[model samples]
Structure formats: structure tokens, C-alpha cells
Target: INEDSYGVDDEEEFHELDMTGRVIANNYRIESKLGAGSFGQVYLCEHVRTHEQWAMKIESHAMNNNPQLSIE
Candidate 1:
């Protein structure tokens, strides 16, 4: 799902605040952003199935080093 689909504003929405506690993809629960660089944002997602969380990173430098930027 697109982040804008949720109607979240950039200024009003802060990654740290949102990452505090929230669920995404109706399955992967957001734990936190492991790190954020020029590439993109990396988040720690928890799999609802096995309750196992993994590091999911998204970048926006398409055609470069990283691609696909994710906002949450």
C-alpha cells in the first residue's frame, strides 16, 4: 500500500513518532527504522505469522545504487 493512501503528511508525520508503535501491510508490524541513508529508509518489520521481525530497507535512487523509496 502506498504511504499517501493513508493521507499522511510529511511535516505532520515524523518517522520516529510513527515508528514508535504501528502495524503495516495488515501483517508486518512496525518496530522501528533500523537506519536511514541517502538510499532510503530501513524499517524493522515483524511477521505476524511467526512473529519474527526482519530488516526491510527501501531506497529512492532508482537507476543508481538504490531504488524505491518507502514512507511510514
Candidate 2:
């Protein structure tokens, strides 16, 4: 599926981090972006060993400076 299928536009100004194809926490491999908003982006990820998929919500650091809103 293309970006249009996910309602994402290439011309939009987004602050979400692009983590697709990257491994997180040394286990979860990021697959694709599911959705994004003013807060952050959600990604479809998979467990490298078990192949279990999960949705991970990651906040955009460029949006705000409040420490409470950060996932890191």
C-alpha cells in the first residue's frame, strides 16, 4: 500500500519520527506508520523473534518541550 492508503501525504509538514525498518529496544522491528497526529506517530512493529505485531506510540520531540509528554 502507498502513503495515500494510510491517509498520509508527502507534502504535509510532520514532526513525527520515521523509525520504519529500524529495531527498537533491541527486539521490536518497526514496519510502517499506522497514523500520526499533533502529539506523535503510531507505528506497526513486530517482535523480531516471535513475529508478533504491535502498535507503538511515539511522541514527536519537535512538537513541545514538556517532559511529561515525551516517551523517551
Candidate 3:
């Protein structure tokens, strides 16, 4: 996908903490980093069954503490 389509300024925004390992949430397994920010990281994931590509944005501790930064 084009970089502009994701609306991310840089790939660095998607860095994940070493302690934060891959997780399966809502039946989706996070594959890799797609993009990120101070609040969270967007992961490139796939459907276990359908094998479809999808993006999953996970909130970080810093973001959860700050109520102002919210995704609409």
C-alpha cells in the first residue's frame, strides 16, 4: 500500500516495545508493524482463516493515560 494512504508520517511511529510480543486479539494475530505513534502502533495482521490483510492499531500505556488522544 502507498505510504500516503496510511496517513503515517514515518515508519518509526510503529515501533513496539521488546516486552510487548505478538498478541492475538479479537481473533486477529498481529504480524508486524505497519505504522505507529506516541499513543500506539498499527500492526499488519491477517485473518487466521481467510488470510486477508488488515491493520490493527494498538494503544500504548502513554496513550491510555492521556484521554485527549483518541481514534475516531
Badly placed stretches (over 4 Å) of model 2 are 1-16, 62-72
Candidate 1 C-alpha lDDT tens digits along 1-72: 334323334432333234535666678777887886655467888888899978865433331332333223
Top lDDT hit: 2
Report the lDDT tens digits of candidate 2 across residue range 8-66: 33324344347689787788899999998766788999999999999987655444566
Deviation (Å) of 32 in candidate 3: 1.6
Q: How displaced is residue 17 in candidate 3, in Å?
A: 1.8
Q: Per-residue lDDT of 1-72 in model 3, one digit per residue for the tens?
A: 112213334435434342123446455666777776776667788877888978876665434557665532
User: What's the lDDT of the predicted structure labeled candidate 3?
Assistant: 0.56
Q: Which stretches in model 1 have alpha-carbon errors above 4 Å?
A: 5-18, 59-72
Model 2 pairs in collision: none
- Each prediction's TM-score against the native? 0.54, 0.63, 0.57
Residue 23 in model 1: shift from native, Å? Answer: 1.2
